[model samples]
Target chain A: MTTTQVAPAPPGTGTDRPAVAVRGLVKRYGGRAVLDGLDLDVRRGECFALLGPNGAGKTTAIEILEGVRRRDAGEVLVLGEDPSLAGRGWRDRVGVVSQGEGAGQALSVRETLDHFARYHARARSTEDLLAAVGLQESAGSRVGRLSGGQRRRLAVALGVQGRPELLFLDEPTTGMDPVARRQFWELIRGLRADGTTVLLTTHYLDEAAELADRVGVVAGGRLVEVAPPEELGAALRRETTVSWLEGGARRSVRTQAPAAVLRDLLAVQAEIPGLSVTRPGLEDVYLRLVGATPTTSEGALR
Target chain B: MTALHATPAEPRGLERLRWAVADAVAAAGRDVAHWRRQPAAVLVAALFPVLLLLMFTYLLGGGMVVPGGGDYRDFLVPGMLALAMVFGVEATMTAVVTDTARGITDRFRSLPMAPSAVVAGRCLADLAGSVVGLAVLLAAALAVGWRPGGLVPALAAVGLLLLLRLAFLWMGIYLGLLARDPSMVVAVQILVWPFAFLSNAFVAASSMPGWLATIAEWNPVAGTVTAVRELFGAPVGTGGGWATEHALLLAVAWPVLLTGVFAVLSVRRFQGLSR
Candidate 1:
């Protein structure tokens, strides 16, 4: 297959450019390339979702951007600075909410947040952070004693307490229940409203659809596609599936234009029973982009 | 949300160092708080060495003989101090392993604090725990008539024992980072027992076989034991053996060398952890 290459731009795009930029980023473990020359751009104040299966190098890419892991080859910039060489001031502007529960099991929720607040010069107050995460009722409870959802909320609160310009949330809602997940999404939206650029990785397609302004689908150590949710399902737009029952018999038709097909169906009968028209969802488009069996491995992390 | 607060007044060099030290102190405070919540674990760890000292000094002291003429408790006390330092390694190992398992180390990595605070905090907290253990053991030893020759020598003996503890702290940090599982700390603990026993902790090297005696005299634990003995004015063998002749030097050298090797290895391991 022929690969088209884009020309590189001159240095210093602008002070008000994207919050994060990655060009030709490559990472390898032993001989296996986890990230095969990836490129990504996350604009300021946008909630960008990175969708990938397990082992698709999503975590590796995020860690490199967070300055926790080094990339073998890349021109990566986070918050207008090279992440690999970013200093402590750069680190202070970036907050990371990782996959696991945080430390300080014995520390109470308020105390844990209070301790972390000291590490940052412009951290939010502990009480306000607790209320934001909906953990005010459990402020005095030890972190070890809280439920998994509460712990994850506390983790998110800690991540944002420093008032970072950029925040990376890696599987942030992994253990949250439906209500908690909705609540967390509101909290993320709040952050975006406050001009915090959020780069999120999640297995939940619904979550990405609800929170992300744009989504990037990664598979086989490569970003296969990136676009808005509505545009991503465009592949399935050419063919529409219509299902209905006529004369007690089930009937279905696939057509390029659903409007034309509906007109024809109406001409055949005055009214059709149990009629329904369906278009592919973001999950369908995502699975097709990643080239996997949509039923079995729709959101499986590669 | 609050307008970024005017860049927050960048800290100076000394201020940064002070922040790092404060971070370590806060982490150590967290560990102390955990100990307070689980007092049983601390009690067991702190009192075990003291109980062993009592059992040995009273039950086994009468039968044991030093190379030079002296009461067994006087000889036993210095060795016990060295034993206490060795014994404390398990606590350090366990604490490090537990922190790793609980994702505490990963949490520390994500924070924007000083990089060395995690291990440094651990060493400081473990040192505090060891000091408590040393004090209890010393009290038990004193109760059993284990007296130093003078006040100055007793203080010197304590200073040497603390030095040995500091050395062991680094060793423990290295081992803790190297071990993958908390259960591996048990294996490390078991390994420490042989190193302690093979030294001149429980008996005189001269009373053992010639080959074993040679090994014991050269053992790093033996160096600390001999140095503490000299500090406490305990009996040093009349013969110009290797341990008595170079007691002070070996005491300092053993800790320095062990700490150097382990400290370098620990820092390397810590860097490798990001991988």
Candidate 2:
């Protein structure tokens, strides 16, 4: 019940410490361990994205850290205190935007936001929140009547209104339109620019790549890989696959030197059919890391 | 606004009480806020007990009798008030189950707001609504020519009704947390009817068979009904049991006991929801 753990420095104090630290987090449902001894550390003032497939314990792990769900065994420190045992002061510094709809349907959009804002000693004004989240027009609309995207934006607004020291966002942009998604990214970027610590879990790799300082891929209840988006699957990224037509059959070679392979193929034939070099992007590296067969447009071209 | 990421420790004593009251008011205000957008729904819920009062008083009243000789209206009116208090429980359960099911309860829990704020707020809000419903039913009772005893006793009767309501509010809240799904509450709502009829809220328990009378007399609703009938100077039939003999005491004890039991159960269930 008690363990020595470093607490995150006060916001805007400019210290480098893990805003969230998890050690041996174990959660079981009906004798099946959803989170099997997962360990992770997300540093302060950075956006860390957790990527995983469905039922990979990403949600379970996030809820545990948020203090919404309990863990069988784990040492968790969010802003330096155990989430499950954390009290009001802990909740004050932590902001959570859980997945799915939780806003009261009876209240108007503005009213819903106002109600949550009262819980915080400091909070953004309702006008600013509505304007920032682009819900200004629907401010008077019932929460239940708003579109899915609008509701998601409202959730995001509620999460950040407290100007939390640590923010937990679970699939924040699931139902957002392209413009809304872009706007959401900008909003997050603004928060990060303020030295806020954000932990995001999302299915969209591009979203992870676009926003994450580092992305951690989780599978089977543990981190498969955690690295900067560019540095993720470096070995996989370094290898290039060259595919073309040979003897009326498609052929491909994965190699460190694709230029030499292309030149040698051209030396054999005046014009190489389907001669293309493909480097695995974040998606490919992610797909392969999660044990999915990474495919490229060239594969579908054939 | 003064930002409080600076205060690592929570405030103590009076400050904590201030937060508790403020948070409870805010959460309770949320329920009242719902009434603004859905006035019709609120009106219907308030008037529902009045409908039952008319039905039982006019249609069912002719066949009913008080054992010791009094107007059937006198006996039936007190019982109807208790019945009305029990009936409002459906509203309490539905609101709670819907709130918990839709994830608002989780959201409430996640906030830094006072720990007991949501529940106390719900208690305040529901009890306030019950007060309004009670007023409406009382107005209907007066319109129907059902007279009662002195104002002081009548006030005591009203207190008993509200106390019974407070107890059921916890009971409903407990059941709602247990179910966590609004659909499951439908079964409970259906079950309330048989529960209401089984109490002496309708006929005098003395008229039933010996065993049935004992069971009905012991029903909490019957305890409240019988106590209020005494308070209103109505015929409280001759029944030979500890429950009937001490109606006023049982009336107070039953609700207080139920409130303690269910409040603990509801809060514990809410805290363990993650498990």
Compute the interface RMSD for each candidate structure.
10.0, 6.4
Models 1 onward score TM values of 0.88, 0.93
| lDDT (10s digit) by residue, model 1, range B25-109 | 8788878888887899888887888777887777887787776688778888888888888887778877777787777787787
List RMSD in Å for every model shown: 6.9, 4.3
Q: Worst ten-residue run, lDDT, model 1 chain A?
A: A1-10
Per-residue accuracy of model 2 over B24-135 as CA lDDT, tens digit each: 9999998999877799999998888788888888898898877777788888888888988887777888888888877788888888887799889999999999888888
In CAPRI terms, where does candidate 2 land? Answer: medium
- Cα misplacement distance, residue A22 of candidate 1 (Å): 0.9
Two-chain complex of model 1, DockQ on C-alpha atoms against the true structure: 0.35
Error of 1 at A131 (Å): 1.0
Error of 1 at A79 (Å): 0.7
Clashes of 1: 6
Give DockQ for candidates 1 onward, in order: 0.35, 0.49
lDDT of 2 at B95: 88
Q: Choose the strongest candidate by lDDT.
A: 2
Best by DockQ: 2
